[model samples]
Each structure stands twice: as C-alpha cells, then as structure tokens.
Target: MPENPVDPPGLDLARLRAHLDRELPGTVQGPLDAELIEGGRSNLTYVLTDGTGRWVLRRPPLGHVLATAHDMGREHRVMTALGGTGVPVPGTLLLDPGTETLGAPWYLMDFVPGTAHRDAAPLAGLGAPRVHAIGERLVDTLAALHRIDPAAVGLADFGRPDGYLERQLRRWSTQLAASRSRELPGVDRLHGLLAARLPESPVPALVHGDYRLDNVLVDEHDAVAAVLDWEMSTLGDPLTDVGLLVMYTELAGVGGGIIPSAATAPGFPSAGELVARYAGLTGREAADLDWYVAFASFKLAVVAEGIHYRFRQGSTLGAGFERAGEIAPVLAEHGLTTLKER
Candidate 1:
C-alpha cells in the first residue's frame, strides 16, 4: 500500500462510536477499525470494521462543494430505496444528514466483501472460469439497472428530465470555462456538436452516473456483489449509462499482456455483447447510442478537468493528476468521432 496518508476530515472515532451506539445499537460489536480506502479528489470513503462486522463510511471531501453535489443523505436514501431491486448495491444501515453527528453529512453501509479490480492485471492471471460468468453477470446487472423505473424507485424527484441533455452540455461548458489548467482545443467543438446533435430519449431510467468496471465489486465466486459509487446516479436516459459502460471497456485492456480471460473465451461476450444484450432486454433500438456515447465522453472530460485543476493547485498528489489533463482531449476526440458517425 502507498505510504501517503489521506487527511480525512470530520471522521472523529469517538463521535462515530457514539453515533453507532445511538443509531445501530447491536449491529457493530467490538472496537471499530477505520482506514482510508482509496479516496479520489472528490469524496472520502473509509472501510470500518469491528470483529466480523464491516461497514463503509462515505462523505463529501473536506471543504466546500456544489450545493446539489455530494449529499450523503441523498446517496444513502437512493441506496436504501433501491434495496431488493436486483441492482446489487451495498446495504445502507444508517444515515446522518446533519453535520452534528460526523462534522459532515455521512452514511454507513454494509461493507460489501469482494475484490474491486481497478485494472485488468490481477483479473487476467486469476485463471478462473467463473470470470466469464461474472462478465455476463456484470452486463446483466447493468441491464437490470437501466430497466429500473426511477419513479418506482422514488428518484423521479431526483433530477430534471426535460432538457437533461441541455443541462449536461451547459454544466460541462461551465466546468470547462472555470478550469484553471490548459484547455484542450477539441473540447469546445465537441460541446457544440453535442448541443446540435441531441437526440430524443424514449424514457428516463435509473442511470448509474459512473458505470465502469472499477466501481463494481466481484466476490470470490466471480459474482458481482455490489455496484459501488452512487454520487452521480440519477434518473436519466438509459443510453447514457450504456455509453459510459462502453467507454470504459478498455479497463479490461490494462496490463498489456494480461486481459480478462473472459474477453477471449468462447462463451463470454465482449463489451459490444453487453450493449446488444441491453438492447435485447429493454427492447430499445441501439441506433441512438452514439449521442449518449459522445455525452458520456464529454461528461468524463469535464470531471477529469476538475481533477486536473485541483492537482495544479497542489491539493492532490500523484502523476495521475497531470495525466488527467490528457483525458479531455481523448474524450473530445471520441465525442467528435461518435458525432461524425451519427
């Protein structure tokens, strides 16, 4: 593990213990062992454990943030609402919306026990036949998410449906404008093209804001245990979710020589297979997916730019921060290519 310690603020052990005693009662016994579990520039997630009991504490990064963003209570509510819907999410146990409890709004959920593969290196050499099954299951899980009725899940009030694409275009444009780092030339053009080529969405579905391999947890049996990270999730066009899933297909391309064994197996389907399966399951045509693909690319570019800006301010470490600046151009290129094809 890296030696650099993350300065996770507002996580007072004594306060958390008091809250647990008042809220959870008997769920967690013994002393809690909380450690920083991979934090990005945005939120802080800690893996808390006590004997056989484990839970995850998620809260906004220490400091200011957009009003609508990083609301732990909202995240917790969404997770709790989606329980038993076959979406494969961590079980939400307690939610503390007021900052009085943890210095910031936060929630505790059952720490899903599984391997979160961020890269393809470890997955490739595992030599497990269940990898293929897990891959298929991953696709199926996404299909299930896209098929979920946001209204039924109480997320109809989550996000605005009308002008959703327009709002996204403007949001990214604003982020691009506010960016302090070097701006990519293709980004503005991509945004313009996206605005002009917006397509009609059939219906809004529950879209996992970041639907990628790293956000998914796979158990020892190669089963997807949970879909982690719900910060960006909302009711939106299902195609957006599909496009994001496709955009990160290269995750399995990591480690150069070692690819997920499922990619080569006869029975296992590729990323394209997953998209086709989504179409098959939802009975929706895949022709309009290009626009969503472009949208996904553009959206990610905006997010990457935010990290790049923070890195320049000396708030974050690692060469990956500098590398993040490159994502905008690549994503812009992808968006342009998708638009041209359309």
Candidate 2:
C-alpha cells in the first residue's frame, strides 16, 4: 500500500493503490498523487499519477447522489465498446464495481493529453482558420458517432432508443421537479409546448447526450483527441445531441459566467453552419430542428435549476455554483421564444 500523506476529498489513495495493485499488478510504480479535476458538476473526476504513469478516475459525487444518475459501469461499458469505433474516447483500463475500495464504484482510463478549451479567449488567439477547422472537425466527429451501429459495438442493449425523445422529456421534467426550489417563469410553459409538439424522431443512434467543444479534447493538429464525459451517453435520437450542441453554441455567453463556452470565439462555426455541416455529413434532414433546439434549451434549464438547487442546499462542490440559478430562467425564456417563433 502506498503511503497516504493526504487524500483528496471523495478519494482514498491508499485503498485505490492497493486495489490497483490487486487488479492490475505493477501499474503503480511509486507514490500515488491525485488532484480533483474542477469544472465537473455531476461525476467527480480526478487525475492520478504514480511518478511514471498518469490516468483518470471517475466516481459519483460525494454526497446526495441520485439513485440512477451516476452509473460508473455504464460509462465504462460505453467507452470500452466504442474503443474500435471511429469515435475517439479515452481507453478504459479498469472498472471497480464494488464499493469496498473507494466507497463507490469507480473506473480508470488512460489520460489522453490534449486541451479542452472551455473559454473563447484562447481559441480567439488560435486565428480564425484554425478555430473554424476545429469546429468543422467537431461536427464531423459527431456525424461519425451518429453513423455507428450500436449492436456492432456490443452496445445494442445500452439504452432503449424507442420513443427516446418523449422519455427524455419526461425524465428531465422529473429531474426538474425533484430539484425545484423556487418558481421559474416560462419553464412550465416551455415544457408544455415541447410536450404538445414532439417531432417524429429519426432512426436512433448511440448519442453522446452532452456534446460540445469543451466536452472533447483537441490535439495540437486541431484534431479531436478524445471525447470526454460519457455519463449521459445512450442510444437515443441522435438529433438530441445535435440540438444540445447547437444550444450550447447559441447560448455561449448567456450563463452569467457559470457556463463556459468556446463556441463564441472568432472563426468558430455558427450554429446554422454546424447544423448544416452535421446534416451534410449524416444526410439527415435538419429542417425541423427548431423543436429540437427548443427542447435542448428546456433540458439545460432543468440542469441549471438542479445545480442551483444543490447550491442552495449547500451540497454542491467547488466554485461558481451560486451563479447557476441565474441561467435557468434565461434558458427557459430562450426556450419559450424558440417555440413561439416556430
């Protein structure tokens, strides 16, 4: 067992080292050091090093975890299944389902080196052509992901795709209800409008539920290195992912400094361009994406509300949580306007 001078919150370094030694011997050659990675609102991510090798570990949040929200096994299984596919994902190394070691199920994967640009300033310095190319590649990668057959990747049973959009609406509504603390104007109306106008979903594909520029890591050559954060991945209406991407890009700076976005940087593709590029690559009709975008806005509003709830309850970890509440109403208003315009 490695000496533990200090263990970061939500991690037990000595037990983790012992488990690693037992599961995969000699993986750790020296003292293990870990630091919790910030900016994660759901799963707790950490970067670990043993003076030789570096890896990443993910686990559920420390306290007040929802029953089905943070499934470590699901994340591991999806990434492992997509290993051979064109989608770039971190190579999963091990999954510990039992809670004996870390008090919760956790998994580790190779830490791919790249930059996850969350803000627009750095990307603005990258010049317009490079940023534009990166944006195009981002869309192209998403198209490739949507083109994959779930069964071919051993993920046919990953999630039930039938009526995915409808179920998604219900799920988020329940989530919002669970986290509701104060009245949010327009949220209920947005939800009602979405329920009244659910579009016919196209053929389902494996969807990265939260697809955005920052969720992916880009390499020096401006290619996507690996897509990160698969807690939300499932077999669903692929356009839901597209709509989320478009929403993030469109609402880049509207989060009151709570939501970080690189999409607003100079040379990044416009929301319209991104939608068109995705349509061109996947040959899917994007004409009826207005509803999808509106739903995306509503979904994000729910998520922001959830975060605000946690913050108010004093259960949220890290900085900038207090500002999350401000974004919910803004997103709800945007969602309402989107539906009204259609």
lDDT of each: 0.72, 0.89
**Each model's total of backbone clashes:** 0, 0
Q: Which candidate's TM-score is highest?
A: 2
TM-score of 2: 0.97
Q: Tell me which residue pairs clash in candidate 2.
A: none
Please provide, for model 2 over 7-121, each residue's C-alpha lDDT reduced to its tens digit, 9 standing for 90 to 100: 9888899899999999989888999999888887788899999878899999987766655678999999999999978999999999999999999999999999999988889
Q: What is the lDDT, from 0 to 100, of the residue 69 in candidate 2?
A: 73
Give the distance in Å from residue 160's predicted Cα in candidate 2 to where it truly belongs. Answer: 1.2
lDDT of 1 by residue, 48-109 (tens): 76757778998876543544557787778888888999898999988888888677888989
